[model samples]
Target: MEKTSGWRGTREIWIEAAYQALIESGIDAVKVMPLAERLGLSRTSFYGHFSDRDDLLKALVTLWQSKNTGNLIRQTEAYAETITEALLNVFDLWLLPDLFDSRLEFAVRNWAHTDQDLARMLEDADQVRVEALQAMFFRFGYDPDYARVRADTVYLTQIGYISMIKDRPSEPPGPRLQRMPFYVEVFSGRPVSDAEWARFRARHPVAS
Candidate 1:
């Protein structure tokens, strides 16, 4: 078996440093020397984890896909009895990226503008997300065509937020939470109950 202590720690440090640089500036700033400086390590340390700059970039993309798309797929596949519950399950994924790196999301998207291969990967990732949503709706007995459109609406709107660079509010889980019921209802083709909203609010508590 491969050893896991020191090498894993070192690789994670480099990945985290690169992630920070990618989000704060852009992919251009995610160089070995700069990242090593940020981590207070030697440039040679990067070589221990990665073959070169391209290798590091590929790692970043793999990290992103695993966190973002992977979790969304898992959530979409989860059980939900009501349309409200089903919608909430997927909506929760959208509201907070928890394990997903939203900043890295924007960074990679910006990077894709010039990279045909990255753009293609992004397109495939997007299809996967939409299909997952469509599957969720389909499981709820929604028409396939309608489910696809709803999926498109939800996915495209979220992407729009990143592409437009909309300024997120400082205090959240309030305004955003309040509007979620309407979104669920619109997409699921079912009315959300007051009790449902109350439950959602209770689950995602914010200070008054």
Candidate 2:
């Protein structure tokens, strides 16, 4: 175990250790003693930050809410000239790990299967995300009902893709990314112009 010399770590350190544990080995592995060990801190140090394991778990959920759901909504609201660009903005979450943590998302969703409260929160998050997408489409002058359906299609398809690939090794960006323009076209019923594609591609040079 790597040890930190003379370091008792901070609240964020403990929470981040807990977060990694939760994502890597599920909630069952996010215990104070183990986290302290992982951080090279004493078990007592964890209590200085969190009251108990439950408190740490709550903090983890809050982190997820802020990082994943919050960023998704923000992406939908990001400035874009055309609906295709708007959809591409949201797609940034999938391509950019900093924008959205898919592993953390998958971990929390699996954890939710056994926790009723978390399951409800996950449902609320899904609704909030879909509504954000709907609003994005609406801003581009799509009819309300059609916007909702398109939003559902966009959100559900991404969720399904996440679920399907959760356990697989990360693939090269080129294969999947090549399909994104087609996906944007399908989602927004608009073709991506060369300029728009170039802008999006520049943001993700790995796909070039």
Candidate 3:
């Protein structure tokens, strides 16, 4: 029997490797051999864990959906008690990624196009995310319809922004990562410059 490569470090090893593989290549590129290689194991090891590439992909989608749903909702709540803070939290999720990966986002979205089954899986996961985000918006004082609309837009915007960043010119990337904060500010309607926030504060002094 082939050795099974799994549950290393903190979380499942094969699962983490799947996310890495998604990042390096789109879902189309995540073949069993390459994924096994990335995990520093043989195909026997990979098969021992997953019956095939499709099986592994299904597990990856399930794992990501469960974990990322919480992260997205938590991020939305960080700006709690204020609509702006809560809504901007969605933007924050997009700008700062740790709960999920950019490459995986790209791969699955592309994969959903031609594959009906995968498309259904993504639709269901998206529905859950939308529900979570909508609830956050409602908690922040929006009506159901508005919450639904805004949540969908924000969720989809993540896919759009990742596509832009991924398509950037390959000029070594430079130090342009700093610009992400600015993007967050614009998307979230937050004051990008400290000067702006300070000026607003001066106009409306604190009560205490």
* Candidate No. with top TM-score: 2
What digit string (tens of lDDT, one per residue) describes model 3 on residues 47-91?
A: 666777778878877866655666776776664545554554454
Each candidate: RMSD to true structure? 3.8, 1.8, 7.5
Give me the overall lDDT of model 3: 0.63
**How high is the lDDT of residue 71 in model 2?**
100
As for TM-score, the candidate ahead, 1 or 3, is 1
User: Which structure is stronger by TM-score: 1 or 2?
Assistant: 2
State the local distance difference test value for candidate 2. Answer: 0.90
For candidate 3, the per-residue lDDT at 160 reads 69
Superposed model 2: Cα runs more than 4 Å off: 1-6
- Could you arrange the candidates by TM-score from highest to lowest? 2, 1, 3
Question: What is the lDDT of every predicted structure here?
Answer: 0.80, 0.90, 0.63
| Residues 30-107 of candidate 2: C-alpha lDDT, one tens digit per residue | 988888878778877887777898999999999999999999999999999999998889989999988898889989
Q: Between prediction 2 and prediction 3, which has the larger TM-score?
A: 2
Q: In model 3, how large is the Cα lDDT of residue 88? A: 44
Clashing residue pairs for model 3: 7-13
Root-mean-square deviation of Cα positions for candidate 3 versus the true structure, in angstroms: 7.5
Residue-level error in angstroms, candidate 1, position 172: 3.0
